[model samples]
Target chain A: DVKVTQSSRYLVKRTGEKVFLECVQDMDHENMFWYRQDPGLGLRLIYFSYDVKMKEKGDIPEGYSVSREKKERFSLILESASTNQTSMYLCASSLKGYEQYFGPGTRLTVT
Target chain B: DQQVKQNSPSLSVQEGRISILNCDYTNSMFDYFLWYKKYPAEGPTFLISISSIKDKNEDGRFTVFLNKSAKHLSLHIVPSQPGDSAVYFCAASDRSGGGADGLTFGKGTHLIIQP
Candidate 1:
């Protein structure tokens, strides 16, 4: 089966600490996305990479960044974890912007 | 502003009944719509999708209906099972904006199935 996997299912971080959430897809899709899923706000895209080393800011890219060193892997980085940044982080991959396959998600708790 | 809207935050239905979840969109440029089901602590999974060219699409017990004129679409689940209970998010995409696109999602409707 096609699969998207994340490095962590849950993470706890202290304020001001740098954080990295990793995702990988075996499908060799060119498009990879990072989104923060929050109550009442739904899934807001933080950043996406259509190709390796190419990234674009999404609707809510503030305080976040992403890296796509390889086509099969995309990473979301929080420069500094804050209490308000605590939320579910999702990673997804798609071929040519079509139906996306998502990872299980990493729930981050920044305290 | 939310381009895709799921006004209902929650819905409850009994087992063996039909569960209707509604969504509306404001962007006329949107040509593709999709429904995703998410359980707690898990990522949302693609459920069904409908393109602007079609009005209805069905897969097994789930169906998606699109009304382009009204800018509305809905997902129907027949004989709602407990396993079917989850958060449903409506999303849309417009390729006109350029680049490989990302989806605009609604707040999500939490569906509850009771026996």
Candidate 2:
């Protein structure tokens, strides 16, 4: 079985603070994705990396960025956290043509 | 524009009955479809998938049906259990390759099993 682990299961931060969410996968999949899930809107892609040091902006990537310094690790960074940024964030990894395995998710609250 | 759409926001069914969740997509290029189940405070988990070439794919009590002409697909859960209550998301993918492009997801449908 594939396992994806997120650094934090829950987090709280004040407005204007910078936040980092980490995710690691044991499968060594080539594709890693970051998504923010909100009520009524569902899962919206934030960013994705196909390989180390390569990233692409998803549908919603305004205040978020990503880093893939290693094959098994991917990080999501918020330059300036805002109250509206509070939501459930999910990390997923997949090999080409295969189903994606997701982490437990990080629920971030910005106050 | 929303490429994939789940018209129904929620559905309720009694235990031991069949629960049907529907999904539609505007992108004709989508050749693969998937269903994911998500519980509160948890990430979505892959359930079942169907390729465009096949009309139906079944696994255990869960089944997925696809209609290429209508660009629609559905998931049917037989003998719905209370534990099956969760948010179901439908996703579509145009191609499957080792790249950053992931599947496009719908708004999701919350299935409530009435026991």
Candidate 3:
């Protein structure tokens, strides 16, 4: 079974603070994605990487960026965290044209 | 604009009954559909999937039915148990994009099973 692990299960940060969320997948899948889930609105893609050092902006990528220094690891960075950024963040990995396996989400609280 | 929609925000059914969750997509380009179940504080888990080429796909007590003409799909869970209670999200992908593009998801429907 594919295992995707996140660095933190819960986090709290003050406004304007920079935050980094880490994710690692054991399956060595080529595709990695970051998404945020909010009430009323479902999970919205934030960023995705198809290869190491390659990233694409998803529907909601503002204030967020990503890095893929290694094939098994992907990171999400928030340049300046705001109160509105508080939400559940999910990391997922998938092979080309296959179903994605998601990691235990990180619930972030930006106060 | 929302490409995918789940009209029902929540559904309540007695345990051991059938739970039906519906989904609709506005994009005709979407050819692959999937259903995911999410428990509180946990990431959504892949449940079942159906391709445009088929109308139905079954796994265990969960089955997905797709209607290409209507651009809609439904997931049916028979003999639903308490463990079946969770948020169900319907997602679609344009396979022609070669899977690099992430899936478009609906708002999700919360299913509650009452014993």
Candidate 4:
């Protein structure tokens, strides 16, 4: 089965602090994505990577960035955590023209 | 503007009843559509998908129908069970980048199945 793992399930950070959320997929899929889920807003894409060292901005990439140094690993970085940035983060991996598999997700709170 | 829209915020259905969730998209570029189910704290999981070339696709108890002309799609769950209670999100993709562009998602509908 396809397994996607995130570094943390829950995290708390202070405002202005930098935070990193990591995700790794065992299936070796070519595409990795990061999304944030908010109440009433559903899930909004933050960033995505199609290959190692390649990245693309999604609909809501303003306060976030992503890094994919290895094919199986993708990381999402928050330059400076803000109250608005506190939300559930999800990671997904998918092959070309296939459905994506998702990680358990990380709920981050910025105080 | 919201490219995808799930007008209903929630729906309640009794066990063994058919539950239908509807979605609409305004973007003509969306050629592929998908449905995802999400629980409380877990991430959303892929449920079903339909390409623009097909009008309907089914898997077990779940079926998805797509109408290109109306830019609408719906997911139907037959004999809804307790496990079917969750948030359902409708997503669409243009496939212009071969899935690398990601997908646009709707606000989601919370489904509740009563026994």
Using DockQ as the measure, which candidate wins? 1
Q: Is candidate 2 or candidate 3 better by DockQ?
A: 2
B19-98, model 3: which lDDT tens digit per residue? 99999999999988999999999999999999999999999999999999998999999989999999999999887865
The deviation in Å at residue A19 for candidate 2 is 0.5
User: Tens digits of per-residue lDDT for model 4 on A8-41?
Assistant: 9999999999999999999989999999999999
Q: What TM-score do all the candidates reach, one by one?
A: 0.98, 0.97, 0.98, 0.98
Candidate 4 deviant stretches above 4 angstroms: none
Worst 10 residues of 1 chain B by lDDT: B94-103
Off by over 4 Å in 1: none
Give per-residue CA lDDT, model 2, range B1-115, as digits (tens).
Answer: 9999999999999999999999999998888899999999889999999989999999999999998988889999998999999999999886744375588999999999998
What is the Cα-based TM-score of model 3? 0.98
Q: If candidate 3 were superposed on the true structure by all CA atoms, what would the RMSD be?
A: 0.8
After superposition on all CA atoms, what RMSD does each candidate show versus the true structure?
0.9, 1.1, 0.8, 0.9
Arranged by TM-score, best first: 3, 4, 1, 2
Mark the regions of model 3 whose C-alpha exceeds 4 Å error after superposition: none
| Candidate 1, position A109, lDDT | 97
Ranking by DockQ, best first? 1, 4, 2, 3
Model 1: per-residue Cα lDDT over B5-109, one tens digit each: 999999999999999999999999999999999999999999999989999999999999999999999999997999998999999998666666798899999
Q: Interface RMSD (Å) of model 2?
A: 1.1
Chain A TM per candidate, in order of listing: 0.97, 0.98, 0.99, 0.99
**Alpha-carbon lDDT, every model:** 0.93, 0.93, 0.94, 0.94
lDDT of 3 at A14: 100
> Across residues A13-106, which tens digit of lDDT does each residue of candidate 1 receive?
9999999999999998999999999888999989998899999999989999899999999999999989999999999999874888899999
